[model samples]
Target: ELEALADPMRKDVSVVRKRIDVVNKELKPLGTNVQKKEKEYKDALDAFNEKNKEKVQLINKLVELVGESERLRMKKLEELSKSVDSMQ
Candidate 1:
């Protein structure tokens, strides 16, 4: 009677082990695909960040140029005002 009970339990364990092996085999390729997709996502994110940095640098340079232009315009206006006052 003990042998009979043990026999069934051994068969159940064997069946479970076989199912586990099949599941592991199926998961291998899926795991590889997940890793590949993760790498691609990381690379795209890096590129986007780099582009944003370049855009910020360009904007800063534009701001500097605009400030310089305004300063030069004010200086030219002051010179013209002095010339006009002299003629009065």
Candidate 2:
């Protein structure tokens, strides 16, 4: 009777070990796939940040150019007004 009980218990343990090995085999590839996806996400985020920085720089330069153009136009207007006043 003892021998019969021990044999079943051993078989159960062997089944459990096989199941664990199968799960581990499946889990390794899943872990590697997760890592690859994480790297891809990080790379995309980095590229987006770099493009945003460049966009900000271009906008700043545009604002500066607009301000300079306005200032020059106002100066020219003042010169024209002064000349008109002198002619009268």
Candidate 3:
């Protein structure tokens, strides 16, 4: 009676081990694909951040250029006003 019980239990354990092996084989490729996708996402994010930084720098330069232009125009207006006052 004990022998018969041990035999079936041994078979069940073997079957379970084989199923686990098959599942592990399937998971191996899935893990590799997940890693590949993660790397791609990271690369795309890096590129997007780099482009955003460049855009911000360009906007800052534009603001500086506009400010300088306005300052020069105001200085010119002041000089013209002084010339008109001297003439008067």
Candidate 4:
């Protein structure tokens, strides 16, 4: 009777071990995939940051050029007004 009881328990333990092995095998590839995805994310983030920096620099230069052009145009207008007033 004891042997009969232990036989079923042994079979159950064997099935559990097989299931654990299958899960481990499935998990092994997932680990590598996770690492690969992490690397891809990091590379993408780095590229985005670099592009953002370049965009900011270009915007600053544009602002500077616009300010300089406005200053020159105002100076020219003032000079023309002074000459017109003298002539009148």
Candidate 5:
């Protein structure tokens, strides 16, 4: 009777160890998934930063172009004023 009781207890311990091993195996995949998601988030942030940088550069170029256009218009007005004065 004692041996029979020991056999059941031994089997129970063996079953518990197998379940623990399965849980350990599952943890590796969970860790991998977490790492993959973190990397994806970082990559997305980098892409956004690059896109914003391009936007800023284009805006600056547009501002410079507008300033140059104004300068040309002012020069034309001055030249027309001088021509009228000379004619009079």
Candidate 6:
């Protein structure tokens, strides 16, 4: 009804008020927790970025080593072919 919509009841209002009070009470500690978690996340990201740079450098070095290995393999195959041709 319109009366229910306009006022509802004091008990309903009181319940909503109590819930709001409880939420406000919980928010203070939750705020500190959020700040602590945010700092930890930022520190972790910084550390990960530092370590990621090292990983990228190592990967580049590994790629160079692989290229050198391929070059060596081609040279060895060429030498083998030359030897086989000489035998023929």
Q: What is the C-alpha lDDT of each candidate?
A: 0.97, 0.97, 0.97, 0.96, 0.97, 0.97
On residues 1-88, what C-alpha lDDT tens digit does candidate 3 reach at each position?
A: 8988768688788899999999999999999999999999999999999999999999999999999999999999999999999999
Off by over 4 Å in 1: 1-3
Give me the displacement of residue 62 in model 5, in angstroms: 1.1
Per residue, candidate 1 scores C-alpha lDDT tens digits across 2-79 of: 887768688788899999999999999999999999999999999999999999999999999999999999999999
Per-residue accuracy of model 5 over 8-74 as CA lDDT, tens digit each = 6887888999999999999999999999999999999999999999999999999999999999999
- Candidate 3 residue 11 C-alpha distance from true site, Å: 3.0
lDDT of 2 by residue, 20-83 (tens): 9999999999999999999999999999999999999999999999999999999999999999
Give the C-alpha miss distance for residue 58 in model 3, angstroms: 1.0
- Candidate 3 stretches greater than 4 Å from native: 1-3
- For model 6 the local lDDT of residue 73 reads 100
Q: Which residue pairs of candidate 4 clash?
A: none
TM-score of model number 2: 0.81
Point out the higher-scoring one by TM-score: 2 or 5. 2
Clashing pairs in 1: none
Among these predicted structures, which one has the highest TM-score?
4
lDDT of 4 by residue, 1-88 (tens): 8887768688788899999999999999999999999999999999999999999999999999999999999999999999999999
lDDT of 6 by residue, 1-88 (tens): 8877788796788999999999999999999999999999999999999999999999999999999999999999999999999999
Which 10 residues in a row give candidate 3 its minimum summed lDDT? 3-12
Worst 10 residues of 2 by lDDT: 3-12
- State the displacement of the C-alpha of residue 75, model 6, in Å, after optimal TM-score superposition: 0.4
Per-prediction backbone clash count: 0, 0, 0, 0, 0, 0
Candidate order by decreasing TM-score: 4, 1, 2, 3, 5, 6
